[model samples]
Target: MLPPILRLLATPLPLPLVQGMAQASLTHILREHPGLFDRLGTFAARPIAISPTDAPFDFTLVLARRSVRVTRRGATPPAYATRICGPIVLLLALAEGRLDGDAEFFGRHISIEGDMETALALRNAAESIPLDFVRDLAPPWRWAQRPGQAVLGAVRRSLLEREGVPCN
Candidate 1:
């Protein structure tokens, strides 16, 4: 569970800011890996909601259209074919292929609801790509890579520490 202070602070954030951040991040990922959603096969058209159980909002990914929509947790959400609910860190780890989805699922670290096929397709598709979000978000400059990755790594380590996960 996330700290109460974080939930409190995030709960009242402007919707546009949250949605815009999601869009920008999605744009970067798609730019870095074109045709990334094409590997979802028949599940590409299905909307998937990624809910960070410890967060104040959920992200509904419309992979078919290459966009994401953020919805406040307590508000009514649009229809989604599948929902993957977990801690934000675990979700990121899954997308980055740093964590085994099957093991986490079986270990009860994450929960999947709705269409199982869509979830499985997503897992397989994500696993096929090596996503380094830190590098992907950094400016495409040779000199920026190292410092950018270092800063991002430090931020991630702090977040992990806050979640009581040991940093290597």
Candidate 2:
């Protein structure tokens, strides 16, 4: 049976509300880690976009004055330098070091565009962070991944069947 009506996040939440919460979370993490910014120092003023190939929204992270910030300008600046795109699950795994970056890249599951320096800086930062920060993200992600993909396929089939559309 379909789940009963429940909504954890109402639609049309104010953009600032989400951004502010994200900023706060990052700020809290930085306060705990204390040296992450130094790892990201190379891209201090530059914008680096993180895109999930399956997700509609993308955001850029910028470090300024030793603080990390997220922005959704949606406009790609030449200065934006590095952009990474991958399925949501794999991307999260990549950040968490649960999977090899090279395997994901060569498997064609992830793609990188633009400046190598910014990519390197981001890579180093992801590697330097204590696993506890990202370890929490992977288990739930890995657990739900297969079932989630199946559900998406089922949704597509159900919609197409209703529309008299044949999907081969």
Candidate 3:
């Protein structure tokens, strides 16, 4: 279970606040990792876009908030756009080199729309970066698992263990 303070922190905030945080976080990550953008030419021959969609889990995340729309053809660095329910989750995954373009992240609620090849290439480049360096930048809520899950789990167990006293 999460601490009360952490639970409060996980609550969705305003869109503007989320967008501001996303933009600042993206800028910080890009600035700290110069080689990340420099290596884009290796992946995308054409520009690619990624768009993320917010879901029940994290409402404030603005999908595709940090995107590079125009990029050179045959560029080593890949371009991408993403729509994620949690910007911090996406950022942390990117920084940690754990992003899988073909994985079921979207099916699980992390959406990405773009050129498959370019997206894969970008994923490769992002994976090359040292993830640990960006660990401190991860959002506070990420520090613990979501509280709702625990509550739901308890409810499920209670329902399963109770004796059947009535018919529907």
The lDDT leader among the candidates is 1
- Each candidate structure's TM-score, on Cα atoms with residue i matched to residue i, is 0.86, 0.61, 0.44
- Candidate 3: stretches off by over 4 Å: 1-11, 42-91, 99-112, 133-168
Task: Give the Cα lDDT of each candidate.
Answer: 0.84, 0.59, 0.43
TM-score of 1: 0.86
Query: For residues 1-168, what per-residue lDDT tens digits would candidate 3 score against the true structure?
Result: 223453456444554565466556655666666565556664433444333222212212212233333212232334233322223334334446544534536545344554455555566667776644324244436544345445544543343233221111
**Higher-ranked by lDDT: 1 or 2:** 1
Top model number, TM-score: 1
Q: Give a tens-digit lDDT track for model 1, residues 52-88.
A: 9989899998877888999999888789999999998
Q: Candidate 1, which segments miss by more than 4 Å at Cα?
A: 1-5, 139-148, 161-168
What lDDT does model 1 reach?
Answer: 0.84
